[model samples]
Target: MDAILTPAGLLQRSAPATDAPRRRPTREEAEAAVRTLIAWAGDDPTREGLLDTPKRVVKAYGELFRGYDEDPHAVLDRVFEEVSGYDDLVLVRDIPFQSHCEHHMVPFVGKAHVAYYPAEGVVGLSKLARVVDIYARRLQTQETMTAQIVAAIDEALKPRGIAVMIEAEHMCMSMRGVQKAGVSTLTTQFTGVFRDDPTEQVRFMTLVRSK
Candidate 1:
């Protein structure tokens, strides 16, 4: 198990360990698994219309979970220090993303807002969105994903402060269980000055809410 950071900046109980190495399955094996699942659902996977469905699903899964192969640190590696002593909040808002729930493997579509106060240098604006996409492409929970975005920027940029907020609608919640549609979940994480300064947090929220 690995410890997960909470939105309040406290370390809580560890999450299930995901670092264990295992043999990678072949494409044929993956497609076979999909066929087995189809059969379990009482569908004929070999029917003419369904014969290619397994291959299609396996291909889709490869794209859906590609983030697991990406390194977020690499995305933020190039920083430009040519700022003329500009020290203020740099924010990118409403970065749309789609991710799968780690629990049920269903989708949770959302938007992320990221902000940071530069200490000396700053990353490219698009890099912020790239970072969000990298993490969002993985199996995730909203809370863990929020914390990860904040942590990555804080570590890679060493900024004066960092704040991230995510608004999402989870299919696992809406399409199943209680089945409450049109509901959204919001999660936020702040680090450094953003965590200690009340006004900075407010300012970030205000900017995020601005039209």
Candidate 2:
């Protein structure tokens, strides 16, 4: 008969292998993949309008999904502790972000509101926006994007708490698919004290909503 195992033993046995991390596509590989996708969409990739499209798209994607190449941790590596004893909520709002929805490959344009209570340090206001762009420029779901914004800042600043809210209109919903016209989507993610505390969360919401 097989011996019974403790939860820790079971977990250890079930751990994922670390031998191989997935490889990213080379530039040529990426371009080829895009060309194939263009063909599959029933468009003449060789047409005058599209003759150079693959190259252009590959370049565009290099910029769009460049987040895949960057480490979010590194993006927030440095921190500033010269708060001058100012410990109130630090709010950065109305940061414009443009992203593509992974499901439909359509655009979503909107603003991100990011805030955090510093534990020991803080990051530049613009870095927060850059962090938002790093995540937004990729194909992502609004939910994940919202969480990533909060998580990146949380990691960078070691904040007491972090709140991120995104409100955007998706072209996938407006232009095609369900075609909801002007309907917009809202997604929010809270971490640390923001998740366990009510007043802090409400204040963050009120501030962002005022925008």
Candidate 3:
């Protein structure tokens, strides 16, 4: 992909995100909607015990869904070129995250394992985790979130190779229909060398699984 320049004046692989078309609901409207949900759930929203539940849920939603207002590219805009030429695979494993399932709006908690081989430069280790958190804050499927992590890093850093693995337990499956817990869903995404070369992919997984 051709590099695109970002507002940060840095060249990256993807374009900046555009704002959503529709206007966001006001706080009052959001809280009111929560009240409606509470009532639909066979609860009294006006009761003393449940009176402020809507407000609390709305406030929590703001934090949980703040990723829509965040920019993943910005987190990775700054690149560090001075690695003393030590350009091997940089991997960050066990990155814990909690993302809401788009299908049911329930949470899927998981840890992300990320690896990338630098082409231009490396980013701060924390930035990779931050990228995961940003995307995880939004409504997502485990599969889509895994690919998005790879794309965000691949675009911002234009790495020679990139790999992402996510293992999660979705509440939609456990706490609802299936009712069976402890089941995990694993998803992976590979690009460049990691995609073209099978051994590299093996090595990436090996490192992640290793102690």
Candidate 4:
């Protein structure tokens, strides 16, 4: 029998085998690979069970962790000057967030408690959330993520102090990988005044726990 090649097969034959291996996957490549993973995992990728999953997951990721492409200073560029000279404590609590643990690449579900005391001026409420997202998107450990969030706030605002607390359940522990199942971790970072003054630190802790 003579050989016959389909267009895709010909392309595959002519294409350099190592081309893709030499380069990192782009966002689209990652998404497509994820769909491929579904197929490899003993299921039909085209089934209604997964009809929109690939697109939805890709879009959700771009929205959830869009902070990687954002500059922290840019997020903090616009500050609020209408605080009536109220410099005391600025708290934005229960800033809900979700992240992927670097160790297992599984989800970590949690809320962040962020606060800072203005050094020169204060930032918008949403910037705190942006800071949280910035550090959360990357493969991360809870401890590092907590510290990064605090550091970003400290650097951008140069606040008298900054504090971050992350209370989360890591799927690396909860899901199949290790399977602790019901354990949660609390991680925190404090800077400047939040670290210097015991009274101030205690107050911030109290407020975060109150509700």
Candidate 5:
């Protein structure tokens, strides 16, 4: 996929592709790095209480960043064209996700609301959730994550239009600098007809805001 900066100044992927290849550290190497961090924080990594902490952290990292192991396009490859002429809007809202911030390695928890206007086909509703999870499992920024979700569906499904909005609380902000607890960050992306038509955009917001 190609990454582009949207008008909102968010990084967005244009198409889904296999994850890039990179040299990965071995488990021992990862544990050693965690040990270094522990010592840097003035903790004795070798102490009886902390001796296994590095190992545990390394294992946890594997689960936390498993998005690298997945191909989002694969999840969206299956399309069902027999919609029986039902083509309005397919929206999946309030998809809960957890991701670590790439800059701080701290977590941000959020919900994503995804909507697409089908041109001729539709995929399973669950597939949209899976796409969100595939991206959420990686280290991210909320703006970029929102754009990526919309891009994946737009490219794979060729939808008439797509919209994505994400609302999140970043631990890096709440637990550290400025420490404004309960504050939320919001980001959105729109494409195709959703970008050209103001009424459709308003309708999308209405549907999203409706209880």
Candidate 6:
């Protein structure tokens, strides 16, 4: 697992990100791939300051992409049925998340707003936030992540209605591409009552923006 060290830096990926992984690159292989990227980016990975860079980068990537190992449905599995007769919109706002863009591999950081009307029971409020984190920790588009959150909750909780909105700033745009700073992209998804009634959508938005 030792060689002259690759200049890839962090350019190479370990394996295809999917539920079923038949094979994955070894740690040395991953580091070498990073070294390959460093060389591609015009940096000498063997330099004194850069010697440990590949290892650090690989470690950081593991945390950033831990979502791949998580089960979204499991987060909502423990629901609380005792609502005392409560049946209305349950909103969890401003759940901050960081995700990588599938196309560029740069980050898109933002906050997510989620809400749902209870059909049978309710999940722990924090469980909603956990769901957001599960999807956000993966490479994704804001649009797909938004729908995925709604779908996960819908299937696990069987809620009467669901609403999810995400607003993010893609680093690919700010750090590269057009280089327009502070530009935010927003995405949303709705189902059941929220999808059927415009007023409910308004209500969800109002609560999210309030304070």
Candidate topping TM-score: 1
lDDT per residue as tens, model 5, 1-211? 5678865344765755657665788998999999999999999999999999998998898899999899888999999999899899888988999998988989999899999999969999999999999899998878778877877887788888999989999999999999998999998888888889999889899999999
The sequence of per-residue lDDT tens digits that candidate 4 reaches over residues 1-211 is: 1233432111112345454554655877867977998999988878997977888888887776665677766787776767778888889988888888766678898889998888778887887888787777766777767766765666566788887788988888777767897687998777778888889889988999996
lDDT of each: 0.90, 0.80, 0.88, 0.76, 0.88, 0.87
C-alpha displacement of 185 in model 6, angstroms? Answer: 0.6
Query: What is the Å distance of residue 129 in model 2 from its true position?
Result: 0.9
Candidate 6, residue 137: CA error in Å?
0.8
Writing each residue's lDDT as its tens digit, candidate 6 over 103-200 gives 89999999999999998899999999998998888887777687678778887888889999999999999999899999999888888999899999
Q: Quick one: RMSD of model 2?
A: 6.4
Better of 2 and 5 by TM-score: 5
Candidate 1 lDDT by residue in tens digits, 1-211:
4666655453435855576766799999999999999999999999999999999999998899898899888999998999998999999999999999989999999899999999969999999999899888998888888878887787678898999999999999899999988899999988889989999999999999999
lDDT per residue for candidate 2 within 1-211, as digits (tens), equals 1223332111112334565765777878877887798899998877899878878888988887787777667778878889898767888999998999988888999999999888898888878888888888877888778766766676567778888889999999899988898897988877778889998899998988774
| Segments of candidate 3 deviating more than 4 angstroms | 1-20
lDDT of 3 by residue, 98-170 (tens): 9999889999998999999998889999999999999999988787777678778877898999988999999
Sliding window of 10 residues with minimal summed lDDT for model 4: 4-13
Clashing residue pairs in candidate 5 are none
Q: What is the Cα-based lDDT of residue 115 in candidate 6? A: 96
Could you tell me the TM-score of candidate 6? Answer: 0.90
- TM-score of candidate 1 against the unseen true structure: 0.92
Off by over 4 Å in 6: 1-21
Best by lDDT: 1
lDDT of 3 at 7: 41
TM-score preference between candidates 3 and 4, better one: 3
In model 5, the Cα lDDT at residue 45 comes to: 92
Inter-residue clash pairs, candidate 3 = none
